[model samples]
Target: MTLDPLAALAGLGFGLSLIVAIGAQNAFVLRQGLLRRHVLAVVVVCAASDAVLILLGIAGAGVVFAAIPWLTTAVRIAGAAFLLGYAVLAARRAVRPRALEAGDPQASPGLAATVLACLALTWLNPHVYLDTVVLLGSVANTHGDSRWLFGAGAAVGSVLWFTALGYGARLLQPVFARPAAWRILDAVIAVVMAGIAVSLLLGL
Candidate 1:
């Protein structure tokens, strides 16, 4: 099948626009990237999960999700709880900040725990479903037969964004070398997490 370049570009742009926002997932990714703690695993999970979700959306999972409102409601409750818990953790980290030094064995979490947290941050968040499955799916459908191409483009966009965010974060290593920087970042992450949690609880 011939891919539509225009459709692909449009998908790329749209996907980046959505994922680049200062949301819970991005905040978690940024923190992990800055810490260089299991950065590769985290980036792969996020980007791959997004690709799968966007494809599902393009495949009409949005309609199925809408038809079963209860599923979303259940996920919403779980997501809110998870976000709130994460916010508290971030708040504690902010209150007692640690410098994000690479290879600092004491400061970094194990790979299993980090991967689990990353998965939770990705899958447990309802906005992911809304954005990728529902919203992106709806938009892709507008392209008619070219919708799959749009989805493919979006998948590419996800890969690029996550790769950049994860790897490009190394450039900020100098700044995060200071404990003060870590404190500030954790505080911001706490606020973002709490705000998202409240929004989920309020059904926003």
Candidate 2:
């Protein structure tokens, strides 16, 4: 089947719209980018994971998920719990904010730990599956024969977003250099995380 450029662009726009929100995943990526700690690994993991999930969604995983309603319920419960826990941690960070320094030995986590954390942040959240696999996939399928092209576009959007977020954050280094900035950032992240968790619990 021939690829449709317009369908691809539509997919790209839709994908970006979904991912450009402020959430735990984006918050973590921004923090890592600011700290310049395992930025490449984090970006790669997030982007690659999103690509896989989006493709799965396009391939009709959404139908599979729908068939097993109990699975989504279980995932929602676990995801809500995890988000709330992370929210508390973010709140703690806000209470004791730290500056983002380039070479702070104490501030930097090991590469393996950072990558694992990134993966957890990406995969453990049920919203990721809903957005990428279900919503995006459903959207792509609407394009008929161009669905794969649409999926490819969405994957490209994920890659572009992660790359920009992971690298573009450095431009804000001067702003994040202060402890107060970190405090504000963490506070925002905490609120966002908590809000999402609450929404999940309420089935929103």
Candidate RMSDs in order: 1.7, 1.9
Query: In candidate 2, residue 168 scores what lDDT?
Result: 96
Candidate 1 per-residue lDDT over residues 123-149, each given as its tens digit = 889999999999999999999878988
- The parts of candidate 2 lying over 4 Å away from their true place are 97-103
Worst 10-residue lDDT window for candidate 1 reads 97-106
Residue range 30-72, candidate 2, lDDT tens digits: 9889888889999999989998998899889999888998888
Shift in Å, residue 39, candidate 2? 0.8
- The local lDDT score (0 to 100) that residue 84 gets in candidate 1 is 92
Candidate with the greatest TM-score versus the true structure: 1
TM-score for candidate 2, please give it. Answer: 0.91
TM per prediction? 0.94, 0.91
Candidate 1: give the clashing pairs: none
Best by lDDT: 1
Q: Supply candidate 2's per-residue lDDT for 16.
A: 98
Cand. 1 Cα-lDDT: 0.87
